[model samples]
Target: MKILDRYILKSFITTFATVFIILFFIFILQGVWLFIAELAGKDLGVWLVIKFLLFYSPKMIPLVLPLSILLASIMTFGSFAENYEFAAMKSSGISLGRAMRGLTIFIISLSIVAFIFANNVIPKAEYKFVNLRKNIIQRQPAMAIAAGQFNAIGDDFNIKVNKKDGEKGEQLTGVTIHKRKKGEEYATIIKAERGLLTSSESSNLLQLELFDGYYYEELKTKNVRDEKKMPFAKSTFSKQIMNIDLSMLNKNNMDEEQISQTNSMLNISELNYTLDSLQNSYTKETQSIHDNIVKRTTNTLSREISTSERDLSNLEKERDTLKKDKNNLLSLLTTSKKQRILDIATNNTTSNITIIKNSKAAQNERMKNINNHWLAFFEKFVIAYACILMFFIGAPLGAIIRKGGIGLPIVFAVIIFIIFHFINTFGKKLAQENGIPPFLGSWMSSFVLTPLAILLTYRATNDIGMINMDSIIHQITKPFQKLFKLKSNEE
Candidate 1:
């Protein structure tokens, strides 16, 4: 390696290591804060918290790598600029581009690391993190219950333990259980001198061992139920095993399958399978939406036709009744001259019935309009994959920023990231509810940003100061004004 190359490489390495360490601590602190907040009242150990953070580190690496690269580049170049090292190198006929060659190697290496993290490590970390969260939540009931607090584990169970010993929950001076079954109510109160909780793995049962305790059991009846008290001479085992189905937990163990089959962990063949599966899933969803639209439209049309027929039948019945009333009024009018007023009343009633029928028809038309709108709305996930477009824009922008220091680079990255994130979310909502083209809506930000990123990169690389907005505006305006003046003169 050349002296200049070694010098540049050393600067990059030092800056990258320093930035990574600082960012890693920041991430850890944020993670610890979140964990602490989540487990505020629960009994979680420091080791468990540390393990959680370690498991989460792989996912953070992808985000951290890009920023680290940016900061390293900026600091290294800035330091060279500050120390006149760049000037000295330039005096020796070494161009700026040549000095940057070693840094480019570092950036390429970081990019590879980023790819590895994104493709392999991040996905596994996500899977593990999800499983870890589930495990924690499943075991939370035991961990959350304090010695004197009434703990409600489920809809029908509330328990309070006065004292808890190591591994074994014991010294239960007062234990109260209020349970409500589907169609019955029961209450059990025990004043035990000592108690122990034991778990059996073979049967998956948790047993509560109570010693020298008096048990009062009450069952609700049609009349006021009486409490039955029983005295135990020695240790009485009142074991109520929680029938927690572990099927879901067992299913969660299928992370291995995801790890084995997913593109993140798999080679070319497995990635193909994963992509095929995703495509198939998306296709199936589209097909399902199509089927649902067809079925719903058919059902809606059938209902509208049925409702119209019912309305027609009701109108016909009303017409018949009005005709009968009219005939009765004519007969009355012929018999007595005062009955002519009754004929007018019968006609008015028929008119009102006709108006009601028209109103109902209008309502049916409105319902059909609503159903059509909803059908159009549900068909928009076709564009959900368009979010990948933003990645192309974001990645290159990072490269163009040149000053890879965390400060400005991080702020810019975050702004871009947030904008992209919001665009995706907004597009999804619009597509789902408003019947927007999911593809167009979801890819809108990407479409806009890609050209912008390219333009900016080109300008930045050519040393055409990216911040020269005023000059660009003046150039554009001046050309247009000159063209307009020339046309006026020609006229």
Candidate 2:
């Protein structure tokens, strides 16, 4: 262990740790803001909030770790180069590779740690985080129903509101509720132009007060005549109140993770198994759907051909009658029969359209889920590779730029990271929509930046500037210079 190597490692580590802590905290604050809806009025204690943040912090590591390494590498090496430390090393016969050997080893070891953390630690954290949120929402039903898309209160009620106002978010607008009743003709639906959610005097109940709304219930009738009439009941209301039972909801077992199979909650091996099963399921369902659609579309084609033996005696007479009338096929049918045929065709077309529309939505959702799992599988490897990639680029770039201490070095690191992040996001989104393979999308940033890393390493090692300004200037002025010389010659 040479003193120089030790010094270099110490410097890099110091910068990396400082940058990591700052960035990690910043990102945590951003997380808090992003999930304020779940946190603000929930009465979750300080310790619970801290626990929630702690559970969420692990997921930020993949983003924070690489960027910290990049910025730290740039600052440390850039300071060394700016201070003529590289020149001193070069004078002492210590090459650039030798100077880098210590940091490279450290980075490789750190990348391995990153891989383990991403594979093992992050998934467990995600599972816990999801479950904790679920438990919190369960205990506080108002949090779930405050403002968002459809949120369930046990198995009975689904509540949604267009907007929420007031200090505790108890005030609501555009409220809609659906009550689930098994074996009923249809679930009772309650909609209100305005609504309020309030804690009931009884601890086991929550009061939902609705205004200017309608209650709709479709009646299930045993009588065939009444069923044929399709009876339903509707009532208009100025103000209505409902007491929702909360005793069953207060079971706060945070450790009981009901959702164990989310894509983010699985390790690489689990993801592989899940992905295979999903793909197989997708294939089987797709094939079944294809067969069903084919059977539906070819309903008329697959039928028995109605070849009837026409009376030979009447055939010539019928042909003569058709020739005399100059009639189309429609003219032969009665108007009532024609209308019935048209109605049947229209009904069949409408049914097929409905089936396709419904199938498309479900199939697309299934495909999106599969893509997300594949992305999760690939991302575990990506974070590890990204660490090495960022270091390689940043180290050499710093040495070349020879500027440090949060000036040009920060600019370079930010620009490069932005490009990387943007490309990575684009690829994942594309993959999610099935526009590209998840493998390609996940590693797209690495593939695009690998050559740049190589180029920077080559330039810095060989003592070349970022650009040969002399050559660029010569090329840019060559045509103008030639034109000026020609004019001078003509003069």
Candidate 3:
């Protein structure tokens, strides 16, 4: 029994290591492809690209680990069963249950380690990956600008270039620039036939030198009352220079603590803390909204709470008097007065509807944030449990199929993983949008797959064939067989 356990354990470990390495490589390449647009053509250096891949690798563990476990389990068990080893063990009075005990214990332990890795290591990796990418892009300010598109330079100006050339990508052609200021429009515009971009490594300053350009400035008086026709000045220059401040891009100013406030950068305990805060904030916001609506209604209606019943009775008496004099009042009123009354009612209705819509919109946004926090809280555990669940599915499936090696195992593993992925993604979207309770939405895939795993295990243990193609085909043709027999008897 000890020998058998060792054999199974050894097989699973070797297979798991190989599968994990291959899958990791494949996923990293896929990730690189997805982010190629940002990482490529930037001359970010080989080490930076390597660092990006290293930092990004942890994000793929939750996805890759479970699939590796599933495939390794299938391959291991299938190889044993295919070689008649399971039959020999059964002949010696060892049951399938006993055979699985060693592997099951190993899988349970692995799941715990995987869970801890997800909770601890992944958050830090996510933070580093995000900030490093930002820092890299920020360091190369010129790479951030795109040709043939308006790009803002530190909120001070907008510049566009038709073409970017030269080995250093410093040459710009057919340039257009507009100067911006706070609380004002673009007061100045500049167009150039060509421009050069330069920056100093020691100082956070970007310089743009334009040649053969025209500058246009619009002049306006500060006092609105004394404003005359707006004057404009236009000047053409052979060369001009502009300086842009890049102090904000300084790496010293980067605040990792502030960035880690997002859910992606928090572990389990932090997620729970965030969730609690969000729920508390949501409760306060709802209360505030209710109080605000009540206050607004009270102010707009202009009615005293103490005089409510008296006002109602008095208002009824006035309404009766008004009803009695309705015809007389209509005859005495001017057309403009009637029209003005109608306009006031229409405007009030429209205003009330608009207020309700805005209030609802704000409430929905608050609820969405709360739901997102809850989803993040539940997702950590769901990913951990999915590991154990996948193993159960793969082990039983391998026993039923009785095939070995990578070919059949990979096919089944990929198919099962795709199904799991689809369910998880769909459930996550539903949870984020508040379509379902966060707990239910987050655990939906596990809840669905667990029962399938159980059913497969039961069938495998009971020696029942899940897919008997011959039986299915026979059942379908039975109706046709009966019809032919009836026709032959009649003939």
TM-score of each: 0.53, 0.72, 0.79
Candidates arranged by lDDT, highest first: 2, 3, 1
lDDT of 1 by residue, 1-491 (tens): 89879877887688778978888888777777876645554557777666678777765664455445544555556456546665687689886657666666655555555554455555566567765655664443455455777765444556677766664333355665554545664555545556555433343333456565565555444543232232222234544333433333333332233222222334333454554655565456556655765565466434433323235665566676667676542322233333433454465457546755765465444433333333222212212222223223333343344344456455665666567557656765665453565455555555666676567545534445454434655787998899999999999
RMSD of 2: 10.0
For each candidate, what is the lDDT? 0.52, 0.86, 0.80
RMSD of 1: 14.7
Show where candidate 1 strays beyond 4 Å: 37-50, 136-141, 144-196, 209-491
Global CA lDDT computed for model 3 = 0.80
Of 1 and 3, the candidate ranking higher by lDDT: 3
Winner on TM-score (1 vs 3): 3
User: Per-residue CA lDDT of candidate 2, range 216-306, in tens?
Assistant: 8878888989966877788999999988887776645556666656999999999989989999998998898889977875774334212
Best by lDDT: 2
lDDT of 3 by residue, 319-432 (tens): 766787775544334566557556755665687678778878888887888777777677678778988999899988887778789887788899999999899889988888
Clashes of each: 3, 0, 0
Q: In model 2, which regions exceed 4 Å deviation?
A: 142-242, 247-252, 297-299, 302-304, 307-358, 467-491
